[model samples]
Target chain A: MTEDTKKLLYVMTNGPENPDKTYAPIYTAALSAAMEIDTSMYFLMHAAELLKKGVAETVALKKGGSLKQFINMALENGVKFYVCEESLRDLCNIEASDVIEGVRVVGTSTLADLALDADSVISF
Target chain B: MRTECSREWDTEGELMAIINGCEIPDELHYYLEGSQMTWIRLDGENATIGLTDPAQTRAGRILHVRIKAAGTSREKGKPVATIESGKWAGPVHFPVAGTITRVNEQLELRPVLINDDPYGEGWIAQIKVTNQAEVAGLLKADQARTRFNEIIARDNVKCIRCQK
Candidate 1:
């Protein structure tokens, strides 16, 4: 597809539970912002917790920036963040309304459709 | 150039060796070898690129291959794509500046192609080169081998399974 029409999808499977292990996803989100691609981020499974506001600040990875900063950078850059509903209810134990501001809880099917339709899908 | 003993084999039983110190099977046409990594200059005006055999061998079987979309301009040493193997995910940087022209769809279903045939079916992205002159800056086969050896020596990177 043309550059103007390209849609970059950032899939985050890592959550706040283990920041060190999940650093790749956070870094990928930040890197996507830096690249300025027409980007969108989907937080699935444990990754949904990253939308919990304060949770991102607590997770850190070696040689990488803080999770909070990464998420914030993405949001600031207009990176559309979508939290998986199943993860929000099952893993994070929080309802959709409890999610941080500017984040939306989307269904699994939507995530799947986004993945299938995106020009590029990056899972971290 | 120099040839190393075969460490891996294909179904065809063709003897594969490390040429110019890069893990490129002798069957492929490799114009640039022995630099920090193996790079293929595309047959078209734009250069389609991917990692060399030695680079893929170092990465192990690729589990995921992420590429930037077409028309996206890229700078040298910046990540144009990311590849995952086992538990490690690393970025693939371009050796030259260019605008990405096309990405390989085959990799989405078969990431292992990077291991099975990195230089051939495993080729990654094609770029509409911004500066053709930068091609001269790339390393030759012999130089690439020396550079690969140095990098391997410095990093002391072992195969994923060999780490244990």
Candidate 2:
């Protein structure tokens, strides 16, 4: 790891369309963790629906595996997982404890802080 | 000429095969110029990469897989992931220099996917290559199978997944 390594901020906005869009950001963030780069993934809008218990485990990409599987990979490897607090409440009507173990529900300011700190940001 | 190949699609919809005695699918690209056993699929600057059937079979059934983090550029022919099997342990190297976009995180919990489905669900990484032309320089499909047959024969290697 170097000071120059790019920290990634991945914004996931889609959810359960095919229930498959969620996989990309989680996979990307997990890969960033594997590369030992600093990384964070923020779930926004309908994407917050994925954090509801039992949803992620059931969604698997054709060959990429399940969302829970991907999230576990991200969590085990130290990628920060977050759900938009506003989105969680306004969209899913859920609280932080409603999310799976690794996710934290935070406000937009946290999202901004993470995005600005990242050397690179991508959205899915 | 396309080598004769027979694949048994796993119950979960992935493909695997043992051509002659070693497993080498007829679809993956081969970086065989210097005789590396990596497989890559180049579409523009993005590529999906993994080990050839022969390489995976030689490694035995992978018991674990650990890939490097994404968002980092790797030089061509550098180690990207490490796999441990009951009989052998080895590194999965990339065939081109690029920033790794993703890894098959499925392997962390089910490392056996490498042995069970190396080409599909078992893929090592997806790289955003710096040079797509470098990947174009590698062999594809039939050419890869032909080279794989020669290598398997030369080394007298025999590979079988041995699923119960």
Candidate 3:
């Protein structure tokens, strides 16, 4: 709703297994930012793997172009992006160094912070 | 309620149209004094403002609107509101200096009215004039009609979907 002026947190937990699911976070995040709403997304579990270098570049959703294009579209509009640290290690044995530039890898405490600050949470 | 700066809305003027399909209603005041896309309608010292038809057509389907709050003072050419489509985002600049009286609340849920009816329900804001002289600089109906026709010809743009 346009009257909602609070922050939004989108949890992008669905990874490339169902490629169609990956686009909604970026699409919605960017549109919200354009409307001047505060918005952010968290990459948890398998979705954390998407931030691994070379992963997003290779993943194309049903919408055609690379998913990274959509991710960049969100970033360009100022939607903050974060990745879960535990998921990087537990799910894929990936490290913070492996993530692409612009994505911040943080601990679960950060996710908690996001959850507390957000007025709405969306699980994608 | 007509004033030195206010002109009554002309029903006959609404019938005039650009040969190429741009609808520059004769009664609406096109703000030629600054950047040219915003239109104004003066009712006494108050006014309603919105994008010109060509502007809405150019923007495509607007999905969201964020207008300045009521009681905010706007300077000429400053943003009074902003709108976005999936592919584009831009501000709707004020045509004259005034204090905002109201915004179209319905736009929160249905911004496409900007594309559906640029002239009527799509109006972005109502302002209480603080400077009537600024309003004086606005284009009158005959001039606005001619100027908007020229705008359509020069920009080579067609009016998009509009109901009445």
Per-candidate TM-scores read: 0.48, 0.48, 0.51
Better of 1 and 3 by DockQ: 3
Which residues of candidate 1, in runs, are more than 4 Å off? A1-124, B1-38, B42-44, B155-164
lDDT of each residue in B35-83, candidate 2, tens digit only:
3477887777688988766667665566777788898687776668866
- lDDT, residue A87, model 2: 92
Q: Point to the candidate with the largest DockQ.
A: 3
lDDT of 1: 0.65
lDDT of 3 by residue, B18-62 (tens): 535457787888776332477899999899999877677655567
lDDT of 3 at B66: 90
Candidate 3 segments exceeding 4 Å error: A1-5, B1-60, B64-69, B72-164
Which candidate would rank higher by TM-score, 1 or 3?
3
If both were scored by lDDT, which would come out higher, candidate 1 or candidate 2? 2
Ranking by lDDT: 3, 2, 1
Q: Provide backbone clash counts, one per model.
A: 6, 6, 0
Ten-residue stretch with the least lDDT total in model 3 chain B: B2-11
Best of the two (1, 2) by DockQ: 1
State the RMSD for candidate 2: 14.2
Model-by-model DockQ, in order: 0.04, 0.02, 0.10
